[model samples]
Target: MTAPLSRRSLLGLVGAGAGAYLLGGCSGDDSSDDPDAPQTINWWHIQNTEPMLPVWAAMAEEYRGAHSNVTIEIQPLENEAFKAKLTTATQAGSPPDLFQSWGGGVLKQQLDAGLVKDLTDDVKPWVDGLLPASLQPYTIDGRIYGIPFDVGMVGFWYNKDLFSQAGITETPTTWAGVLDTVRKLKAAGTVPIALAGKDKWPVHNYWAYLAMRIGGLGALQQAAKDGNFDTPDFVAAGERLKELADLQPFQPGFLGAEYGSPDGQAAIMGNGGAAMELMGQWAPSMQASSSTSKKGIGDKLGFFTFPTVEGGKGNATDAFGGGNGFAVGKDAPAATIDFLKFLLTADNQRTSAKTGAVLPTVKEAVDAVTDANNKTVAETLASATGFQLYLDQAYPPAVGQQVNDSVAELVAGSKTPAQIVKDITQVAKSQ
Candidate 1:
């Protein structure tokens, strides 16, 4: 499975005044006679493990075979290591020809510095073949800067068997109903939620979704623009999260739980020790990998969109998630773009979906998703009214980390709702 979107670090890599120096040159031959020219495309991605690692290598080999004059150099790095290496490379005014990108605030920064190519005209012929929502994160100020290969959204991944045991006849549709569900699960002697408290990203999702429900999508963008997050709606989001925490809904010793470890959130749910977890489309694969039996709960797993908050302005269809994509570096060879197009063909996407590693972004490849749980997530995202990338990816690294830190303190009962918002606001302004 792909690593969490929040693992990327964008700090100091694309700061103010860095753009001017990075935008100095253009690379790649636009001439027609370049077909015979030998070229190399440096590519980097974070799928360092199977299914995707081999899948990507196979795709690259195929592309290379098709173009004997071109060579694809693939570097599969761990999540955090990729971010660190990319930071050093970009800051040195050089980036791989094609590299992994989450495509939000960080991509915007890179684009501002002219470190990446604008693919609007180049990809026009085939861009429509992909889902529009999946492209949302890569499109900045009316131009396309990246191409998405996978897409997904965050929602409640629950054990249907456990819900039945808790006597819940229907899935909750509102915040009150969710709380009631938690109460019922607890009363029935089940852990209502499994949280990876050691990883702040999972905790941030609760506050982020709450804010979206309370203030609507515009509130987040507006806050980022104004460098302020200490609004009434944001504070109320924290309070609502506090209400959920007050019920003691998490698994025992959850404050130190890791995300992918044997004793982590996914394992708890996969092993039937917990009723639910709020996670992305990749949850099932993660559950299976972390489980003792090496197989997840299978058909016993169910999913539902996050519940609406009473009197909130946001629509239920406003989705909160992000996905993976590829960005072209400023100095890449012309053949790099061709290799990218080749990698995203319908057949390639279908193969990727078959691996159950991605929620295919290619519209034609959607039917190839054999996993039941992922199919549901793809359907939900297809009809979404709006999309919000994870907060950690949607903002500058420092601001995003501040959100995680503040929310973690709130979850641990060390900070109040007002103080959380204030802390986040202070860091946002500094950015």
Candidate 2:
């Protein structure tokens, strides 16, 4: 389930640089001219695969069966495809009535353009029923614009058997220990880490986590505040990542590896070709699906939160990740939210959890998570002292892309740690 919060104690962690913005929703005639009139909702999502795809379809069909007056048209596209088409649609000002949202600077950009609805009033009645940390990424400047269905953090997903083979007894809790583990794994003839370098974005995960570990959440918020990413903390993050890079710990030909390809990072992890990977909650399933046998590592898989840097400002419990949510477009019919509410019910969330793909955002549905590795993630997130969305989603597109690009080069040995920070700062300033 989502990052557990004891009721709403964590809501005060409104996140960094998330100061103030005048709340406003785009003005449009409500599609429902009559309260119970026939309605049609256009929905877009990126869950274009089995388990989730059919799960969403079943929910929509169930809603249609119950409410004969409603018609929901869903377009489940591939991740990059959804982003491309959504960009084109938003540019044309005709987005779907209900669409997917990751909730960060991207959502903020949509709001600033008056493209999405302000859900503060609409969701207030039951918003608190969900985990406060789950709502953090979707909350901006004191306003709620979207509702997350799943929330989690990025951490080390390791093969327990491989660790045991390497004679490692426990997961590392500090940066120095992690490096030692990597070296030990290498000494044991194991690939220390599985990275998708060709994809670029995946490798950036390490640098982002390092930034959080070294600088703390406020540094990130302050960087966003001043539009500057050239700080000692950030540079130090790059250097630390470079230390890992210099160890040559990634899988062979990792520089050309894709994430989901037959021989890519996930497959490497699933097939036990590597010791570990830095990834999100979905890694296990991705590894399973990409592996030759499609059975993955089974019970041999384990999860661990990112380690702390000895004297870093960030807490050991500050999580770095994000999740998927739904945003009601400005022009949506009243029935749109009615359907959304139906889909998010505790029973439905449990149904989603059983599929092993989603981490339910509803606090009451936490028990539905039964997988051992998933439960560990749920517990880790539940105890997180702070949360950070993925940098690619948390920052504006240009800046996020630059971070990915520069970090990839850093890992590829084309750019030094100093060069990457300088490069990212330039792009951030341009933004």
State TM-scores per candidate: 0.88, 0.90
Model 2, residue 396: displacement in angstroms? 1.7
- Backbone clashes in model 1: 0
Backbone clash total, candidate 2: 0
Candidate 1's C-alpha runs over 4 A off are 1-35
lDDT of each: 0.80, 0.78
Clashes of each: 0, 0
Model 2, residue 99: what's the lDDT? 84
Clashing pairs in 1: none
